[model samples]
Target: MLALFKSLPDDGSYNVGDKLIGESAAEFIDDITDERVVSYYDVDELLEDIDLINESKALLIAAFGIRSSIWRPKLADAIVDGSIGVPVVPLASAWSDFPGDYEQLTSENYPQYDRSVVQFYQYVAKHAPAVSSRDYYTQKALEGLDISSRMVGDCAWYDLESLGEKMCKPEKIDKLVVTDPHQSQYFDQAESLMSELGGMFPDAEKLFCTHGDPSQSPKRQELASNANKYGFEKKDVSGDVSNISFYSDCDLHVGYRVHGHVGFLRKRRPSVLLCEDGRGLGFTETLGGCGFPAFTRRVPEASSTPKKILQTFPEGTIHQLQRKYLGGDRVSHPTTPARDDVVDQVTDFIHQELTTGWHRYEMIPAVIDETYEREMKPFIREISNI
Candidate 1:
């Protein structure tokens, strides 16, 4: 989720804490040649294909759903191939369907701009100061989740990597759990926190892409069969979880579906999109007045998104399907109370991103550890003009 780039103060040349480069840098893809052709929803052809797959060496792009328009051009081609310093590894899905790959897969473990990914798309395309995604109230969701977790600062990553090791005993496999394909409405507000985390993690393994989508009716399949009569496992979103190292040796991925959390967080395991925030994002009437269109999805070509207030619809499709692919345009029709308040806030944002006092928020985001070495290595060495 760390694609932070922000730069869009309506080119009245933004000054408030001066830091722009959002729309996640139009999904940066500097140039991964095939003559740099890209288009998941074109963030400037995903930044010219991350300037061309960072001139090549290591780019494993394979998201099962949340394609930051395709992992922000494989991470701006690994930040312009500054020589296989390669860390652009977005293989998302914690039930992701591109809700910015469930926090861009947790902002790829933080760095690059406080909320990175082009600074939450330049503070929601030039207005800045985030958190509202349509009508949050509980003390403004606890002061906008503690000012988005203290503007997530002190960031650092690019050292830990592994896709096959964290399961010493995720609770001995053979569980075959995959509940019936939930029909989004956030499983009746996440059936009692998914049965209190399946009764406090009772040995893992589960599934369910759905077994009835003929336009779900019977009262939404009796509230998705009362959370698929516990211990869900119905498979076939391509059956057998569509191999990507066998869906990254599933130990846990309890979904409300964001894209199946981009297929098991692209296999690094540990995903939980669960979905929440509400209102049909017209672009910025609120979600805290702008913050998380992954840099306003990329707002340049003769811009227009910072009119001040009244248009922030955060009823959550990650700010309405990435602001229709970062503002390529389209916002009207699918407004049944923000689709049932995005199924009760994607089951309360997946039971509050998987319960247990989540240490009452605090791990990163002071604008990514005081701007990683003073503003992203001099803005990635001047955007690799190196």
Candidate 2:
């Protein structure tokens, strides 16, 4: 049998992002159970050891990102079958419409575009008592499907204990970290920005962190080969805890991955996230004054790239760039600031924190605390009783 709790290598060679997801879920379970035993499993192993799993008080899982067609049926089956005699709870989860939209989906059209999203939630509504999502988008999606869920921010937001006192900008910028995405256009753009960032922090140690395995993906291999072109010392992390700990010493982070941004923020350090998709943007919607959008609200014109958009900064207003690049007007989110305002806030965050050596902290850290008090603690108590 697989070990209930697996230990990750600390040497920083581990690169598969799945380990990050599993480790994140474990962190929450550890926090929730306090003294209870918590074992981790991949979806396949999870199904294989149902009898052993049934021995536990509950099966708390994390499905924090978009689910492909492949995982839809399996996850739904596991939740329904596993929860027959025990409760199954999900944390910091979301149903994103990446690669496609879920807004116009119906039972008839869902199968064409991963209808498993609806099926998965259908099982959740019937089996799980309650579930928490990472964004309002997921809540709205579930609500549209008649499945109720709570938007408690990302589960990773709860990883830190005290926020009020710990929420601080580094007194001095010593280390600067940057992350590149797998997408070719974005990768090129991030690489180009390294020189500009280097000039901004001449003395600070620059590091490039890769969240995915270069050995597996051709794009990652390209990223690895090109990473050294900039002055970045590459550090590959293996698990979620390692990723978080890896960034603990860093003064500031500018990255394309959402979790990298989350890891840095969870450590109470300053960071910025460059949105790759709706997941990053939507997750940021819950962050109050934090988060930025790299592209416009709609499909960007072929002439507009992240590089072009970024090049306009410090001179052209975001609104001006939007018009110049033919990027659409900002879409209003019900809860958080629009994309233009967020970009302005994050711009101030970088400049204020970098130049003045400290920026005034905002609502996110306190919001995470409030979320824990109102949502997580109550959920833990309710799940414990069951």
Candidate 3:
């Protein structure tokens, strides 16, 4: 199974892929019982009187199929220096370099138009820990306006009950799982977001609520959706999985939250995750921890590719461009792993972990051998128990 840590941008714009996370988490739980995929905030929430370290080791399956090793020391330094308290690890595939091939960043085919952008990049140093002290550098951020939180109240368009029945159908449905719960007990944002989502995917047969949210609130703000405003109501579910597994035959699953996406992959699904990239915020960990195909929230406009200019790189050569993303808004910077790298690492780790432990699939290659499987078997089994 793959891991996803990307978050949806609060803007109602076209970040429609966030739904993959919500679906993946549910699929994972359905496949494996013991563990739950979660955000760091989830880790923190489980710390009250629960055997955090033990339960963490027990119920805590690796997120994005990523372990602490890849980012630990570096993450430790971030914490030591107070730049960040923790770092996220992605569930990468067993690839040392970029997979297949890619085209170079261009203004045409890969075009990006910032005509609407008032700032150079909306997200700055996307992963720097929030600073308690508002210093000069952070103060500079006051010059900009952030509207991500605005998307919180908008999930009313993505109602779940209507989605569930649609998903359990016989035919396949290409779905995007949005894992933003508006009134979740811990995150405090699960309920409203889930409401809006319940109204979004009209074709979905099943919309499972990973975290339960009650349907009662006296005074709540409503988030308007450009999609719904443009006229998009979430489809209702009807057929059962027995009729034909629409969800089982999914082509892609993408989301902002990590757990839900992992659930999808654990059940053997393909997915893409939307990065919750921000300026001087948590985008780093959010994206870093993602295991599957992760795209940036800062998409360029169609104007950037008026006629579609295009460029292609050799297979596995996409990763050489990490330097470009490090200093700015692109992916694959010197200081940071390329988007391709992030996907590779997490996928590699999980494939290796699962291959040796469970029954093998010859068609699907296994990255982990028997020895590695034996060692991690306990941890892997723990989640199933939970």
Candidate 4:
């Protein structure tokens, strides 16, 4: 069986940063599946590559942050076209509501967005055999669209068992702050928080980290510039290996990226999440009991300062959150479902779906070769003015 895992763009051009969700999902699936696993950058490429599509038994949409309306159309299209030929299994993903306003689903406010979501789910229900999401809220969002999905938590959480017990607060401040370039609006606030943390922990070795490509992001460049000014150092954490390596030593993490926060948690580091959107808030709320603490961009009127918000959670609170969330002692809460059985269940489902007589088309290699020559020679000649 062949498994194609959808990943972030791999075009020669640089991307913002390597997405941890895509990387983690691909790694986890690779380890567990007997099928040969391959990674593709975009859905369009997957749709166009008939040879790849024809050979694959399963396609895994490695979407870590899938809850936004922006993704609805492409996902819907993938479901409609791809499912006709092969089984598409979306895994370890979450749905996002608009930032700060948790009560409002984007679909309710944006009619076109709602339509896209509904259409996608309608196709998913008819075509795709199974789907999985990161948390209960995302599952409910899918259910709202009349699509059934398994709650597997985030793929990152699958490694929790290996992280050992939760850790207590460190004596000295060795903090790592993860930042996002897209959220420019919050840069001032984040800088303020960093300044406050610096004042509090004079001897603290605060570092500013990013999971994305710095070359592509103005916000990242700006953050890097301000790092020295705020008495913090800048670190680029673009891939899974770097993430694991960097988080291995940090005592505390404060960041806007959900996966960045999860990376810290996976290493049993105490973390404070700076919530930017639905995915951020949902992830924190879902796993808050498990040990994640978050403050939304929309700070309360009373706590005007972002640093003050961080101060609200004392060292004792941080320790408790870590123990409860990552310590392995706590039971699976409703918000944060246990992921112990997800890998086996998802693996079994993929195997079952692949073997259940999914349609396959017989292609003549000679015809493909002839077609390639027929299509490419003229195009090359035209471009060359031959």
Best by TM-score: 2
| Candidate 3 C-alpha lDDT tens digits along 1-386 | 21222232222222222333333334433343444444322322333323333333222212121111222233233323544223222111110122211221211222122332223122211332111111111222222223111011111112223322222221233353434322112122223333343344345533332211111221111211212332232221211212113434453343333323433333444433333222112221222233333322222333444212312333223333432433211332122222433334433433443445322222111211221133223322432343
Instruction: Report the lDDT of model 1 for residue 327.
Output: 39
Of 2 and 4, which scores higher on TM-score? 2
Question: Model 1 residue 180 lDDT?
Answer: 30
Candidate with better TM-score, 1 vs 4: 4
The estimated TM-scores of all candidates read: 0.22, 0.74, 0.27, 0.66
Q: Highest lDDT, which number?
A: 2
lDDT of 3: 0.27
| Clashes (N, CA, C under 3 Å) per candidate | 112, 1, 97, 8
Give the candidates in order of TM-score, highest first: 2, 4, 3, 1
Segments in model 1 whose C-alpha atoms lie over 4 Å from true places: 1-160, 163-188, 196-250, 255-267, 270-272, 277-386
Write the residue-wise lDDT of candidate 1 on 1-386 in tens digits.
12322322222312111111122122322311122322233234435555444453333222211212323444344345443242332211101222222233234332222334443323221331221111112112223223221111111111012312231223233343233323243444455545655554456655544422413245444654565555654443422222223555565554443234333432333334433321112111111121112112221233234411213333233334534564322232132211323334433543553463322112222222333335333333332332
In order, candidate lDDTs are 0.31, 0.58, 0.27, 0.52
Candidate 4 achieves a global lDDT of: 0.52
